[model samples]
Target: MEYAQLGRTGLKVSRLCLGTMNFGPQTTEEDSHAIMDRAHELGLNFFDTADVYGWQKGEGITENIIGRWFAKGGGRRERTVIATKLYGDMGDWPNDGRLSALNIRRAADASLRRLQTDHIDVYQAHHIDRNTPFEEFWEAMEVLRQQGKILYVGSSNFAGWHIAKAQETARRRNFLGLVSEQSPYNLLVRAPELEVIPACEDYGIGLIPWSPLFGGLLGGVLRKLDRVRSAASDLVTELERNREKIERYEAFCDELGEQPSHVALAWLLHRPAVTAPIIGPRTVEQLDGTIRALEVKLDDKALARLDEIFPGHRPAPEDYAW
Candidate 1:
């Protein structure tokens, strides 16, 4: 796997990050361990999870599964750069989620225990906390950093000005600020190109795009639909909305003799501010499929064709100006 620096930080991470949201819900514990083992063997060192994952059954189920894998004692913990998020409702109480100082402290301790690790490589806020001030949030994170509980901090689903506000607050308080931003970005979702990408570029923050395949729309969804005959309603709606574009895109991939998923991932790798795109594969075969994307680099002509199909927005001021 190719490695890149995470934003301006000196730390190196794989171009593709393994996301573990499906660990407990969609995949069993033994299979999850095997998938992680394969990822480690293939040099996919970065893994991302959230305290609120394992959606239906309960929160932290996925993290508990990861903890068991780490407990097996195969140097798995040492070989990976683990990232996890907070800011979800883990309990009935109001303070159970969000970025309040007390909640941040509580959440970090809970995450460390669940992951069976003493420290997190990157601890992130899952979303913006409009209730808590940035000062309060960073102060808590600073404490975690000083105690060596977390090495770096990051954000998810934040707007362009949110990043700017976060970095400015960190600067004023002499803190390291956000090192990365995770957002939904794919061939079907070019909204981040409007401002978030530009803001991250200006602030030296790396982009770790989630949902890079648009819920399998760019992953040969039409072909799969031809066989399975059922899909999530939202995914079905998105596919219907972009049917024409997807037809052209699939034809483009057909000509290249590459899977649509591979081309989608390769396209994200070519974006300027992107450090990694999160890939959440449920099975070992699916996990292995992600590796092929690393080889399918698109040339200028291919890129131009994709641009014509997707037509991303221009950077902020200009996009809004006229």
Candidate 2:
């Protein structure tokens, strides 16, 4: 796997990051460990997880799983660049979950305890907390950096304007600005290209795309109408409900002569602004399929073909907000 620098942080990460949201929910601990082992074997050093994942009851279950992996003492803990997020509703209290100074400190302590680590490689805000002032959030993040709790800061699910405002706030306060952005970008979902990609390019922030396969729509498993219908019924009903989008994705996959996942990921890898595509899979087979995406290089003609298939379709009016 090829490695790239994660924004201005000077940390080298693989082109694909292993995402662990499925752990403890759809995946067993043993399978999660096995996937991590395989990722390491494949030279993937970057792992991304959020505290909100792994359980429907509460937060930090994913981090807890990672803690168990570290406790196993198989040399895996020392070899990976672990990234996690905060600022989601963890059921603490109403308005207790925004990016306030208190929440940032509390979240970092909880994350450290759960991950069994002294420092996080990359710390991120799970979403844009409009309720909190940008200065307060940036200042709190700066304190975390100074305290050695987090090595670098990033933002997820943020728009271009949000990123710009945060950078300006950090600059005025002499705090650390965001170094990377994690957004939804893939062959099927290129909406970020309209704003987020240009902002990252202009400001030197790295981009990590989540749902690079459009929640398995680009994984070739949904090619047949029946299979698509069946898979749609399982989970994440929103993706399944969008019939037009699913059809477009399948047509693009067919034109690429590659699996839907490979086509989806290769498109992201071809972009200069993208640092990595976060890959989340429930099973080893699915993970292997995502890994193969690194090998499917797309040329100019191939890209044109893909563009022709999917075109420049944006999310409908109702699906705009994060």
Candidate 3:
């Protein structure tokens, strides 16, 4: 696995962050533990989860799975850079969600317990909290930092302006602002390349993109066209919309003798601003398969061809302006 600095911070993290969203829902605890073990064996050391994950069954189910894994008494907790999010509705109470300073404090303690960890490597706000002032949020985050409950703070699903605002607020207060931003970025969803990418670049924030495969649309869907037809309505619709391009993309990957998934991941790694692409593999085999991407180098010609097939993004104002 390749390692990169987490934003401007000196801490190093794996280029691929292991996402545990599927832990308690699509995957069982044993499989989750095995996958995590394989991830560690393969040198991946960053893992991300959220407080509201596995909400269908109960809040923090996924975190509980991770907590159990940590309790197994291996070097699991020590070797990993753990990141978890807050800001989702955890219960019926009005204070159960968002970035209110009270909620932040409560959520931090809860996550720490569920994660079986003393300090979170990166504690993130899952989304922008329109109601909470940056002052309030920072104050809470500062308390966590001073108390050694969290090493760094991050944001997710935030807009360009929101990141700017948060960064400036942190700067003004002499606080170590956002160190990373997790956005949904992939070959199919190049939207982040428009503004969020630039904002993160300017703010020295690492871009850790989730859904890097665009819900398996870029995971060589052509090979499983029959199954693709049965996927969710919106995904099938997107497949139909991009059928021709996807076929060509698959052929290109075939010609290069690479899995389309790896090719897609490799493409993201080539981007200047992306620090890591979160990979949520449900099985050990799937997790092991992704390791090959580290060696699948995309040359200029391949990159240009990918650009022609999927197109590239123009930075911010140029994308919106004439």
Candidate order by decreasing TM-score:
1, 3, 2
CA lDDT scores, all candidates in order: 0.93, 0.82, 0.93
Q: Which ten residues in a row have the lowest lDDT in candidate 2?
A: 313-322
TM-score of each: 0.98, 0.89, 0.98
Model 2, range 181-279, lDDT digits (tens) per residue?
999887667788777887788778999999887766666655555656666464346555655666776776676667777777888899868999998
Across 67-174, the per-residue lDDT of candidate 3 in tens digits comes to 999999779999999999999988888898999999999999999999998999999999999999999999999999999999999999999999999999999999
What stretches of model 2 exceed 4 Å from their correct place?
Answer: 221-224, 233-256, 313-322
Query: What are the RMSDs of all candidates, in order?
Result: 1.1, 3.9, 1.1
Give the per-residue lDDT digits (tens) of candidate 1, residues 278-297.
99999999999889999988
